[model samples]
Target: MGASDTAVAMSTKDSSEASLGATAAGPTPAAGTAALAIAQARVSQTDLTGLTLSGRYLVTRKVGQGGMGAVYEATHTLIGKRVAVKVLLEKYAQREAIVKRLKQEAQLASSIGNEHIIDITDFGNTDDGRTFVVMEFLEGESLAECLARETKLAEQRILRVGAQVASALAAAHAKGVVHRDIKPENVFLLKRKDQDFVKVVDFGISKSLRQSSEEEEAVRLTQTGMVLGTPLYMSPEQARGDEDLDHRVDVYALGIIMYEAASGRVPFSGANYLSVISQVLNEEPKPLRDIRPELSEEFEAIVAKAIAKNRNDRYASATEMLDDLNAVIEDPTHSTERAKITGPRRLLPKAPKIPRIAWAIGGAGIAVAAVTIIVALLMGSKAKKQLKNANANPPAARADAGVATVAPPDAGEMVPAVETIKLTIVTDPPGADIFREEELVGKSPQTVEFVKNNKEVNVTAQLPGMEGTTSINPLERKDGAEVKIRLKKLKGPPKVIIKKTGETGPQKQQGGTTSHTGGELGTNPFAGSGTVH
Candidate 1:
């Protein structure tokens, strides 16, 4: 049978039924191969089981299936290392745009090496022309699943998760990438080393900020004027189909995520997608604290700023938002208040009943008598010992006693005594503007002094077409330490070179009609795909 015919037939039968058919007869080697072949012919048009890709990954069984592709549990044949293999379905393999988008997701995600972002190991096409990407196999449920089971999360837990996500976004933004879709489904919660860790997944709709004006205008993957994000979590500009978008859209979606995580429901929702989109574009969401009165006003303010209708009103950068979130978490008074909000208020037990004046007078009289007797004895003993010590050694005895009896200096006072270390900042391309803790601190190839007690100093280098960042921990080394940073050139606008077939000279192309020299224009794949969940 033709490949297309087989795929059509496979789509008609249930996946479970096909799996049962593969193991119905026996577990023998020959029977297994036969069953696998039969199942392949009837479903998927390709037998992924027992198949090896790139002569390394051995596909075992399907772990996850999606509209565009399916993820299989695989192991490296030589190293026996576990990994996940996501393959584009045979049905969509012929769709060039979908194939490109699947590959783009892998490339974009792999480029950002953040702990909170999923890691892509490798990507290529199989011998049978099936495209696939290998990624780290993650354990645990998605944030969406957790929220479904627990409804809402605690205030501290929200901040912890939000901070990690914002940190990942900061790294992406530094590289000029924007994660247009931010929702619970994309936030994965994994348990490693008995601690909860988050990994942001699915960059299928992420936009690159490095594209040229012409390229950006030419690439419209979605329907004309159609919104490109989930209605419930979409930013105002995204819902309005504004072409001039930046990382702020991600901030808006993150706000919606925070709001939903704090309360059981999202800030904006309606019976239908259109209604939700309308609310997102034209109306303001109700205050988060109003829905969950237990939530603090500070928390609500953070969320409100994130989902602000005007992008200019939102946090300037993900790092700025993260700093504010960390501040909220570290504030003692705010934390205590948050605890009270989440927990039930309890009344204190009543004090014991007593005659207030009589009890206080009796206690005072006994204390005064005990103190007077103790003072008299201490004075007598001290005088006798001093006379005897003076007669024996005098100055020598006094000096010895002084050395032994004197208390050490306070711990707090010693902090200022340590000399500040000089940290020399040098970059691959010198003269880049340097920033410490978001404050501009002269140009690179400069030296700054920091107290030894300072554990770490964050440095950011910015130039016209290059940028870099690093953290220097003076405590890790001795004083006069030098931190060398390497700045990478940012992606520049695409250069257009037009050639005329008949004429000897090149022609200048203008407007959207300018044809790109190579490859088709890009588009947002999530335009008509709906919410990834």
Candidate 2:
């Protein structure tokens, strides 16, 4: 019999003896003895120190405890290898649904032979009906701890970490497993062989997408209308409790994680869980560029596509997203066309109106000039005819109309005036250096007049720590155009550099023991336990 079974038998025997002693005494004494027996049984169920499991694992001490189960640091008796043993709490061991889910977590994780995923070695129940799973012990802190210490991650580090995670997710998705609960707390950073390696843990809420005739009924742990993911990173479809979910939900969650890593904040947040879910369902995240402008446009585009509201719009698979990330890592300048955002409407300055008097005066002047030119032409023609006739008949002189003839000035001298328009450039945090066509123009918030041209103009804005450049197309109206550039502050060097610990071998150490009660499941069903068995 298993350890749990033996403990149950012992508890039964103790309760029987207490009942007999109470029967020999009064009814009040019998009730008191029965209460004491129940308390003792509860304590015995949790006290598994120095106990042996399956004749292989020897429990030394408890490492972690949570709502679902408690994790213990154990050693294999024969091999003397350290391992982590996760036992389902006795209170929840009786729940068929919870037990099935825990078993599924062990079975599914063990099947995937991925280096980035936690490895499960064995899983079974104790003699006393307490289920447990044994996995390879790891010495490292979770990504959650790292994020808490370092508010944000470096760009290169984020990409490297994201790529590794995507690769793991790709493996899982290929095998028909969708990790429904993916968060920082579930990602572990282990120091292995002088290198930082990522290990994705906690597949307790993961769903197997493969449909088999025998497992159809067994895969119904998550019923319709039941939500099962973290609200902060939950996708819209998941938040809505959609029954038909796939690997894209994991993609969305990864995008959220990446967003936080880059900006030190999640796109959507609220005072409560419901409010956060509501925001995820109805609100659109603020553009990433607004938070970190120095990030390449291509990188932002990749993230935007991953977190698209519609699953169809997101990357079809994790591999596709990984490819884009690889491209960005190779060349930061690479960019892809994305949907444009028409920002909030601004109240533009009203255009100055041309007075009617000016128009009337201009019109009168044009008419007078036209008349003078016409009269001059008539006189010139008359003089030309007279000269022609005189030249023909040199001997005959006409003295009735004596007039000196003059030729009109050269037509080339009358040139049309060039038209010029005003171009204005403004920066978000004003006083940035402005450049036009490689020529250094004055500082921003300045206006200059240039001859109107049909070609597009390229303008660049630069400051000590912020910079932005854009092309302004030719304006169709004579009022010209005003261009506003929003400059992004450049990201400084990383505050912390995560290095692999030099300790190559694992130390024989154990965690503190803490008794956990109740059967309530939090956001992370298996919070303390790395993986549920």
Task: Give the number of the best model, judged by lDDT.
Answer: 2
Pairs that collide, model 2 = 2-127, 3-127, 4-127, 4-128, 5-127, 5-128, 102-533
lDDT of each prediction vs. the true structure? 0.66, 0.67
lDDT (tens digit, per residue) of candidate 1 on 1-533: 44544554554454445456657853455545555655665454455776778889988988878777888999999999999999988887777666766777798899999999999989998765879999999989988999999999998789888988999999999989898988999899998766569999888778888866664444335345566677889987887778888999888888889889898888778999789988776555665655787875556657766776656546788987787677667454444532211111111322322111112134444464345335534676475355335334523324322222212224443222234444445565667776654545566554454544546666677687787777666565333233556678879732222323453321221110111111111100111111100
User: How would you encode candidate 2's per-residue C-alpha lDDT over 213-268 as one tens digit per residue?
Assistant: 35634545555545788889899999997878899999889888888988889988
> Which residue pairs in candidate 1 have backbone atoms (N, alpha carbon, C) closer than 3 angstroms, thus clashing?
221-523
Give me the displacement of residue 286 in model 1, in angstroms.
1.4
Clashes of each: 1, 7
> For candidate 2, what is the total of clashing residue pairs?
7
Candidate of highest TM-score: 2
